[model samples]
Structures are given as structure tokens and as C-alpha cells.
Target: MSGELRVIATAGHVDHGKSSLIMRMTGMDPDRWAEEKRRGLTIDLGYAWCTLPSGREIGFVDVPGHERFVGNMLAGVGPVQLVLFVVAADEGWKPQSEEHLQILDVLGVAGGVVALTKRDLVDEETLAIATEEVLERIAGTVLAGAPVIPVSAGTGAGVDALVAALDTLLAAAPAPEPARTRLFVDRVFTIKGAGTVATGTLTGGCLSTSQTVEAYPTGRRTRVRGLQTHKHDEAKACPVTRLAANLIGAERDDLARGHVLAEPGSWRPTTVFDVTIRPVRDLERIPSRGAFKVYAGAAEVDAKIRLLDEPFARVRTAQPLVLDVFDRFVVRESGRQRTVGGGTVLDVGPPRAADPRHRSFLARRAAAARGDLPALLIEERGAVRADDVVLLTGGEPPTPHDGWCVAPTVRHAVRDAVHDLLGAFHRLEPLEEGAPLGVVRQAAGDAARRAGAPRAAGLPDTLLDLLASEGSIVRTSTTVRLATHRVALEERADDVRALLERISGEHEALPPTVKELLRAGTPRDVIDAASRAGTVVRLSPDLVVAPSLVDRAVALVHQHAADGITVSTLREALGTSRKFAVPLAEWLDAQGITRRRGDVRFPRED
Candidate 1:
């Protein structure tokens, strides 16, 4: 059937007919392991698929119902949106059934159907009692108000009605958004011909043949050699479908269960995550600082928990996990058999707080739990991508510029700091044009820290350009200054101006060098001041000339353009020494006023 594909995970107690129901529905046995078939117990994840009458393809992730294989169950359920919760009618509700329900609630699974299996083994009155009990147990859970269907796989009774119910459920469930594709590998094996194969329920985005993917935690790169969905080869596979990918570039030993295959650079491995956890209400004790087993998206790792305010905890996994914001996880004590608690990941990689119990730290984390993405951006004081915002807030993509989004408040703060730094620089060194950009940035960081504003590592070029655009700051290739800033000569103003004027009047065609000015008893500071004020121009380390005299030299060269000019000829024409005329000739050539030909210079044609 060429219709929408959906993945549905089955959960219940051991020996509750989960596999039997899936086999009956899909006509393909889900149990793949020989040991599982011999023991008549599902020891690992199984897969099957069927096409509904309405043309919707449904994939089933059959999980082990025994208490010990809960980790496997979590792997299958973590990535699937729809669940088929099974409870045997003859047995009513069992201990594993309650634990699975708790795990589902903690994981925040929002949609599912509660199926009452083994109806043929119970009488009508007994079936009614079992249905009532099942309904009551799930009254406050994700399955509350969900339709409970009584079915018997042996007699094939109510199977059609179950399919009809699933059809309706699939119709109403929201489709997965096209994001970065992630496939949490629950099973890894090698075939006779194929090199390595990994299978999981794909989500977040789509996968295509020949695309490059990275195996997380190990970071080994691989390419997709082939793709299959629902046992049919496909060129591409989308989210909410069971996928098997033949991979190249890695051996079966290199990949294993709990490793994820994702689009290159789409996900990062993280050891620390900030989360808001809700302990199972019937839990005997609150989760505390201790070693625990964490199950998230087909990953099981040992982690330690440290509480952060109420409903929040910082979990540090023993190994890095490929996770994103808002991803759900289940936590069990190191030696406990039941789930202790679970929560949504608030920050995949959180910063280390100086004092985690500090009021400000707690407040910021609380805001993050409430989906305040802008607050997180401000705290980070950096640019983030639209995908990050979506993952964190569960909201639509925000409009971004240059693929990175920065808070306006952060931009304004940096601009203000730059302006303040420029002002201070002008006050400190008025004779200098401006401070170097690096110095200004350092001063801005100090200012932000002093003012209790979050300190960014460095100012972004985009923010700097934005500041320049606002007319508050002027940015050159190397320096930054206030727009209104100007170099003010504080000493020898009158003497420098007088000296420059006399030099220009006496030497109209040529200017004296700084050594000559110094030999004339003019102070070094006076000559420097004159140059800084633009009254005189420093053409080279040894030559300083008045702007008026340089113009006169240009005219003299133009007058001799027909014959061309040389340094010696210009020296004779200006009645100046060769030492003074050589630098002048080179300056004119550099300025495009004259073009050099061998040892001669010609007036520029243009």
C-alpha cells in the first residue's frame, strides 16, 4: 500500500500474547531469535508489518514483556509515537504491565490503544471485570480514555476491529516533521553478502540510499549502501517507519546495539544533560545521587543523578549519548527492577554552574523547563540554529539570518559595550585614532562581567557589523572607535601649525625630512602632532612633507610630463636634494599620480 507509514510498539507483561497478536495481524512471525522461539519468550526486539484496509502501512515493534528485558522494550518504545498496550483478559493486569504503563507515562507517550488480549480464555463476565480493571489502571495515564478492544489471536476474533481502530488512530496522529534524520540502532548484524546492517524505527527526518551517516558514541563514518522499509527495498525512507540499512565502512563488531546512525553533524554526543524528571508517583523512594541505568532511544548507559531544584536533575552518563533537547529518557536504579523516573532532556550539553543550587542557576533551569528558548540563548550569549530552537521548545522554526539566530538583547548589549569602550579609549588616549579591536573586545567582556551581564566568549562579526550600521561605532580593518571620535593634539598645537606653515611656504616644490626638522630645533612631538593633524604627511620613516608642498611637487611633475621625469631631474627642477626628492617621487608613483618606467616617471594618462 502506497500510503503513510507508522510504527506501533507493543507493550505488556510476559506471556500476554503480544507476539501472537502481531503475528496474526501481520501474517509474519515477529520473533527472530531461535532461543526466543525455543523458550516461547521474546528475548529481544522483533519486527513485523501489515497494510491496513485503508491503505496505511503499519510497522510493529514487538518488545520483550519479561521484567529483565525492559531495556529492550524501552529501546523500541522510545522512538515510536503510537503504542499498542496489551493486557491479557484472563490475567487481568500483571506487575510488568503496571511497570510498562509507568514507563510509558514517564516517557510522555501521548497516544495509544489498550488491547485486552486472550479474550477466548475468559468468560463474558470475567472479560467485563478484566476490562473494567484495565480501564481503571490507565485512567490517569497516557492511555486514559483510550479505546480498549478485546481480541483473541487463536480464534481470530476482533482482529478486523483492531485494525479499524488502528486506522482511525493513524489518521489522527500528527505526522513527524522533516528534521535531521536519526535512527537508533537496536539491532546490528552482518549478512552473507551485505557488510553491516542496522535496524531501528527511524524518526526526526528521512534517510536516502548512498547518504553518509555517522555512528554516534564511536563517531565512525559510514555510507548507506541500501535501504529497506517494511521488507521492501526503497530508495529513501521517511520517519515513523521501520528501516534496515546496509552500511559500508564499518564492520559488525564496530557497530552494536545502542549506537545511533544519523545524518552527519546532525547530532552530538553528550555526557551531561539538564532534565526535569517526575518520579513514578508510587515509587518507594525519590531518585537520589547514585549509579543508575538510563534508557533513551535504544541506548542504555550507567549514569549518576544530582538534583537541581524540584522536578529537575543533572544526569551525567558514563558514556556520551547522542541526544537532543526534549528527548525523553527512562531511569532505573542500579540494581532495581522497576523504573525510578523519567524526564525530557532540557539541555543536551549544559554548562557547569559555579553553584548549581544558586538561585539564579535554578531560575534559569526552571525557565528552560518551561520552554523559554530565548532565555537559554541569552544565557549562552551565542548564536544557535533554528533546529536547536525547534528541539528545545517544540515550536516551529524561527526566522534566522545566516543560519544562526542571536537574541536581540545580546546584540544590543554588545553594541553598548563597544560604544562604552570606544568612549573610554578616546578619554585615555586622545592622540591615538582608536583602540585595536581586540583590546576593545577584551574591555567589553570585562564591562559585561562587571555589570552582571552574561559574558560571551567573543563578539560575533555580524553583531559588530550591526553596531557599525547603527552609526554608534566606526570599524576599520584593524581598529574600532566611536563615530564622533577625533584625534586631538594636546601639546605643541601652535608651534606645530606654525612650523608646518613656514615649511610649506619656504619649500613649495619639496618638503624637508624629519631629521632636518629636528636639526632646525623643532620638537619631535611638534612634528608628530603636525602629521597626526594632517597638516603634514609622513611619506616614509625618513621623509615628512607638508600637504601643500606635495601638491606643488605634483604640479611640477605634470609640467615636465612631455619629457618624463627622473629623481635627479625632479631634484634639479625643485632645487632640492636627491634624498628629499627620491621619497617624493616614490610617493607620487604609489599614489598613481605618476607611472614609473625604468628610472623615469611619467604623468598618469588618466
Candidate 2:
């Protein structure tokens, strides 16, 4: 919910006073390893905490100075909130300093402070020249508009200003986010008093004394016996908090920095995953289409980086894929090197396809690495769902099948997909009125969930409206199917190919029973079909088709074609063999469809 945690790391060449500045600021030495002090260079990452004047707590990480520890430096740089690019006033910017800067830039460090150390060793003119050079070097970057402050841990000159600068920045800086929780084991050891304690940055989500955190890659779970941040007990520890969790029944030596700590069900293990990755600068040979180890959370695995677009890229990672894949989503393995770029998993198993739009997305992502979209990636991906952006950006979006970037969210596709099924049910004959929700879901595809059934949040309410508007479906409370797909059947009895028209025409003299009316003699199938067709009217069975041949024949007998007909003579026109003459008399009587008075038949008034 908050922005990001402020975890600053010190990166400077050997003898740049990186350690000394940290010690003076926090009144504590960052050289925790004895080997580091003896060698007069930072050997491993030493963590310290700083409380700014605004009362906000920030973590400071001091990485090693020797080139041998560059790997160690890489590990710490990613999780830190910002970089304090330390340069000695006497020595100015050095080689490793540039390397660190490049790494920071590549990792998208948006906020930094250039701490000009050893100020007492340089004169005013020299100091001015050094500051100008550093300024030029930092142009077109996040630190372009930043202030360059000169301070000596030895003299305390500008120390107050540095603290005040940090105080203001800390208050304004974004809070750290924990999408989920990841605790990478840095060092673990058994203690006489605490039993077993593991130390590392509590980088992801909250951890209290009672919560169980998993040792990842190894798949071990342990409870927090105690917690120490900057060597202080913690009820809840969050981003950049240097933590020593005393875990119950844990073997400290067995747990190391490369191993991870995570909350269960929050973190998972996979052998393959879709990721965005970048090569570290200064490596002479770019990786070919080859396999590399990937580490994420606490999981690690080897996977082939099937480079798309080109075998070699001047860009970092080339293409994104939708993959039904699994691997460590963090900690990419490039040949012999280890990179700390992995953080969260966007998807565990995904479909595969080729997508060129993936490249543009990657380009946009690389351009916006230090800006807003890192958070956007996490939000859209719903991967770690934690707060950190730096860790998960390691793997480009996945490129699965023929290598296309698959949209991470499946809800929209599934919603549209089920419309096909609903449409068919609406338009087709003899279906279940409405298609089964299961059929709708299956037709919707794998990525979608359903809504009405309350199981899958598949098909949202809005989409159902879309279907109705398009006439793709029809509804009346219980039924839902395609608008053009529904069918109405035979609604009339005895309606053969052309039987209905003749029956309607001939029966005009007197209404007939629905059964007898259609009789050029209709059958059950014909009647049922006609009934379904809605052609015949089923008047009561009483009034026969030949109402009274006697009355109508008598009436017709007196009439010639030129003369008007009378009802009594029409009945006489047909004798006992009335069947033949009956219909004819009826017809003549009904030139006006006939009229009747008591038992008499007459021609009706036209």
C-alpha cells in the first residue's frame, strides 16, 4: 500500500572512507567480519540502521570494496532503496566506482547521494575540480539534480548537512513494499544463548517472533525464536531491516546467504519460470541460446534462456513469453555469475506462444525501470503481489510456444470466450434451454474463471450485458444462450407441406374440430408437426367439418351460378350421397363462407 522502503547502500572503491562514513553516521562500525577489518577493505556486506531527524528508520548496507566482492556488492545493491555513491576527495571517482554506478543504473537506482569523502585531504581548488568532475559524470541520471555534499568522517565537516539532507529525503522517500516475504540467508550460526540464529535483510513481508518462515530451495520450515534488526529485538520486521531471526530447531551453519526465507503458500518452488533478465556489464561474451540457473525466493533451477528476436541482444532481455513453466523467478544464472535480479513469480505455469509485442513491452519496461511501471508490472502480473519492484524485474515477461508475450491476466479472454457457447445454446435447436455453466466455462478456456456460479470469477456482470447488446444471447431469468441460436417448433396440428392453407380455405363454411379440420386426413406426426408450426386452430371437436350438408345442399340446389343462393335449397342440392355434394354445397354457401339460422343454411351477405 505504501511506496517503498528506503534502504541505502554504500558503494565506493577501497579506501574511499565508505566504512568510516557509515560508522560516523550511525556511531557503529559496519565491518562485522574480522577478515574485513584486518584486510582494511569491506569483505562482505555489513548492515547498519540509521534514524533520520524526521524519526523515520532507514537501513544502510555497506558492500565490500575488493573486486573479489563485486558479486557480494551485486547481491546487496538490488534490495537497497538507494545508493550513496561515495568518492574520496583525494582520490575522486575510481574504476570500481564507475562499475558500481553502472550496476546501479542498470538496476534502476532512481535516488542517490554523492558523498565526497576525505574532504580534509583536499584543498578548495582540488575539491571544486573533483566535485565538477563527479557532476559531469552523473549528468542525465537520477542524481543529475541532486546535491553534492563534501564530508570527512575524520573532520565532521558537512556531516550535519549530510544528516539533514538524509533526514529530509527519508521523510519524503517512499515506504518499502512487501508483495510477499523473502528472507535470503546471508549468514547463519548457532549461539550459546539463542540456540540458532540466521542473519539477513528481512526484505519482503512482515516477520514477528512467532511466525513460521520457510528456508527455500531446501524446502524447510522453521519458526522465529527471536528477531534482531541492527541487533535489536523486533516484533515485526519489514523491508531493508537487517534481521537476525533466532529460529527454533534450525542449524545455523546449514543455512547460508544464498538460501531464502519465506512465508508458506506465499512462496513456491519451480523448475521453470518466465522472467525478464539483463546481462551484467563488463562481461566480454554475451550469453548464447544456452541454459542458465535461475533462483527466486528460496527456489533455484536451471533453464534454457531461449533468446528470441536475436541470438545476441544489445538490449538486456529481448522477449517475453507466456509459459507453462517453472523455475526460480529470481537469481538468474548467467554462466559463472550470480545476479540478484529475481524477486517474485508472475505466473507458475502458463501457456506458450510467439509474440512480437513482447519486445516493445520489454523496451518500455527497461526504459521505465526506475519509474512507475515496475510497480505496474507487479500489479498487472499479480506475481509476488508484494511491494518490491527491483527483485521481480529480473526476468522479462515469459515467451512460451513459438515465443509470443501472453497477456498475464486471463479474466478478460475467458469472459469473451464463453460467449461462443452461450450464443450456440441460444440459437440451436433442442438444447438445454441454456447451456450448462460447465460447458460455458470449458469453452471459455483455461485462463478464465466464472462469475454467476460463484466459483470462478469468470464472466463478469458487465460482459453479460455486452452479450445482450450484441444480440449474441437472450435471457428470461432462467435461460441464457445465443440470440440467433434459439428455435421454436411445430405449433400447429396436421400441417403437412401445404395442407394448412387448403384446410383453412375449405373450412370457411363452418368451423371444424381441430382433428377433422386438417383432414385430407392428417396423421399424428403431421398433426404434432403442424401444432408446433402454429398453423391450425383447434376449435372444439363438436362442430364437424361438414356442418350440415342437408341445410347447405338444400340452399345450394336452388341457386344457379348467375342467381343468388338460398340456405334451404342448398341442403337439397345434395341428397343422401351428401359426402360428395356436401363440401361443394358448403363451398357455394360459403362464397360468403356461409350463414346459418337454426337448421337453415344460406349464402352469407358479402
Model 1, position 442: C-alpha lDDT score? 73
Q: Could you give me the TM-score of model 2 versus the true structure?
A: 0.60
List the global CA lDDT of all models.
Answer: 0.80, 0.56
Number of clashes in every candidate structure?
0, 93
Off by over 4 Å in 2: 1-6, 269-306, 309-354, 357-606
- Model 2 over residues 1-606: C-alpha lDDT tens digits? 123335677787778998999998988888987888788888878777777766666678888766666667765664555778888989888877766765665455557788898899999999999999889877765567667889999988988888787766666666664345766666677889778888766655778888987776566788988788766676777775667789997776557666777776444443434344444444443366554544332223455554445321211222221111112233345564544233223333222442554444444443463344544454343332222223344233332222222233443454467565565554543324566545554554343332112122423333344346556665455446665553343332223534554444454344444556445455444444344334442222222233243344444444543454543344344333334334554554445545655544444656
TM-scores for every candidate against the unseen true structure:
0.90, 0.60
**Whole-model lDDT, candidate 1?**
0.80
**What is the alpha-carbon lDDT of model 2 when measured against the actual structure?**
0.56
True-structure Cα RMSD, model 2: 15.1
lDDT of 1 by residue, 1-606 (tens): 279889999999999999999999999899998999999999999999999998999999999999999988998898877899999999989999999999999888858988899999999999999999999999988889889999999999988889888889899998775456789889988988788899987886888899999998898999999999977898998888899999988799878888888877667688988887888858755567667988888899999988876777888999888876667899998776678989878776565772543335445655564445545644454455566655444444446644446566566667778887788878887666678877776765555444434444443555566667778888887788898987776555777766776577767555556787788777776676567677787778867777876786788888888988899988887777877888889999888999999998999998
lDDT, residue 56, candidate 1: 91
